[model samples]
Target: MRKALLALAITGVALLGTATPALAHNVLISSDPADSASLATGPAKVTLTFDQYVQDADVNQIAVTGPDGNQWAEGPVTVENNVISAPLRPLGPAGKYTVGYRILSADGHPVSGEIPFTLTKAGTGTPAKVDAAKASGAPAADASATSSPSGSTGIPIWVWIAGAVVLLAIGLTVALRTGREPSQEKTKQ
Candidate 1:
């Protein structure tokens, strides 16, 4: 019984040690236009800042939607450490504009949310040519899906958890077997 308990305790400590670092996802710290901001002129670029480094992945996406329900984000998105930015083609028909983003978090998860701001005045800027798929407000691929530098699928958190569980089971089995032998000998004598 004591050996079994010790095995469980060791397994618990190992699991906690390995799981702590991957538990936190990136949090949005700030933005260029700010959430719920009211602006007279549109920002040339939209920037989102996070509490941790943003993973530089092609799956990272940012979309600026105007009040007219059109995409305003122009050019490719850029990720620099903890900040993600995208150019805008200017905003038109002032009202509310939402900046939606799906970024790969530093911890390998995908963090997605929107920042809404009101455009107090309209500017003479046309929306970007919308792609049929992107217009639907869904990412091209699962942002959470990550690949390693060697082009291999990264090990997911679930796998690690499963491994830990398996290890615990094995340890418990070994401990219970060894614990039973001492009891069996005592009973035989």
Candidate 2:
């Protein structure tokens, strides 16, 4: 019985360790224009704030899509601590805009979401210039596109938890079975 209890305790500790990383994925705490906000004029930039640190990597991306489906975000996305920001070209339309972002969480997972905001009035800003290669119909290769489907770090959180559970269950079952043998021998004696 004591051996079984010890095995169970070890399993519990392993399970707890495996579960912590699952909770570490970054969540968007706030944004510059704010989600579903209606603005009188377009801002020159869009910023997103998260609940945890974000990995500052080239794989991070933010795309501001206009009502016309034009990509309005200019240059590369920048990350500083928990905040990520991207420059915006002058916005020209007077409708809804969607800010789509895929950021690398500090735990190495990719967190993606879209924030929608309405433009009450259009600004005189134009979309950023496209690269000559892209303008000429060549597809641009990017880190996000080339990345493995599992993510940057490859191993997912669920896999770790599942492995831990399986190992714990096997060990606990063996421990309980072996513990019963000693009690049975004592009774026979």
Candidate 3:
């Protein structure tokens, strides 16, 4: 009886834990070249990593713009697993370059942030002379679909409470059933 009570309590706790939403897209896990990295040379590419796998086609995008406000990204964004990368078009003038990205989360919302990297000396390739306005396309940078088939999970709170109550009643019945055994034993004695 005691063991059954303990088992039911453990099950209840586990179910309660599942009631809360999972951390699908809350924190920035990591980035390639790291945030605030001071590199003596300009990187050929920029990559951003997330806590979960991000899709390439739909929501993931990266845009690299120089301090001069000129967009220097070489081509379309590439996504391999959780990492997303964009090419650099001859980085120019030593300064901070902002890597702006937006990735679609597994849960269906868009997540976006900027990573700053400084170039100490100078880059071999001169900055692309493209106008900030001409580089017109603001890459969406969405990485993944935040809401999945499971994201549609919906259950009333009262239903959960009622289920818990039903389980508790069953557990109590098992615990009290032992009292009947003792009464039978007393009569036999």
Task: Please name the candidate that would achieve the greatest TM-score relative to the true structure.
Answer: 1
Regions of model 3 farther than 4 Å from truth:
1-23, 124-136, 139-189
Output the worst ten-in-a-row residue range by lDDT, candidate 1: 140-149
* lDDT against the true structure, each candidate: 0.78, 0.77, 0.64
Residues 1-189, candidate 1: write the lDDT tens digits. Answer: 787788778878877877776777789999989999999999999999999999898867887888887788877789999999988887999899888888888877678788889999989998777673364343422223432333322357677788788877877887777667566788999
TM-score of candidate 1 to 2 decimals: 0.78
The predicted structure with the larger TM-score, 2 or 3, is 2
lDDT of 2 by residue, 1-189 (tens): 788888787778878877788668899999988999999989889999999999988777777778876667876678999999987888988999888777888888877778889999988877655662233221122223533546566367568867887978887897778678666778998
Task: Give the count of colliding residue pairs in each prediction.
Answer: 0, 1, 19
Top candidate on lDDT is: 1
Candidate 1 lDDT for residue 26: 87
Instruction: Provide the lDDT at 167 for model 2.
Output: 76
Relative to the true structure, candidate 2 reaches a TM of 0.76
Question: Model 1: clashing residue pairs?
Answer: none
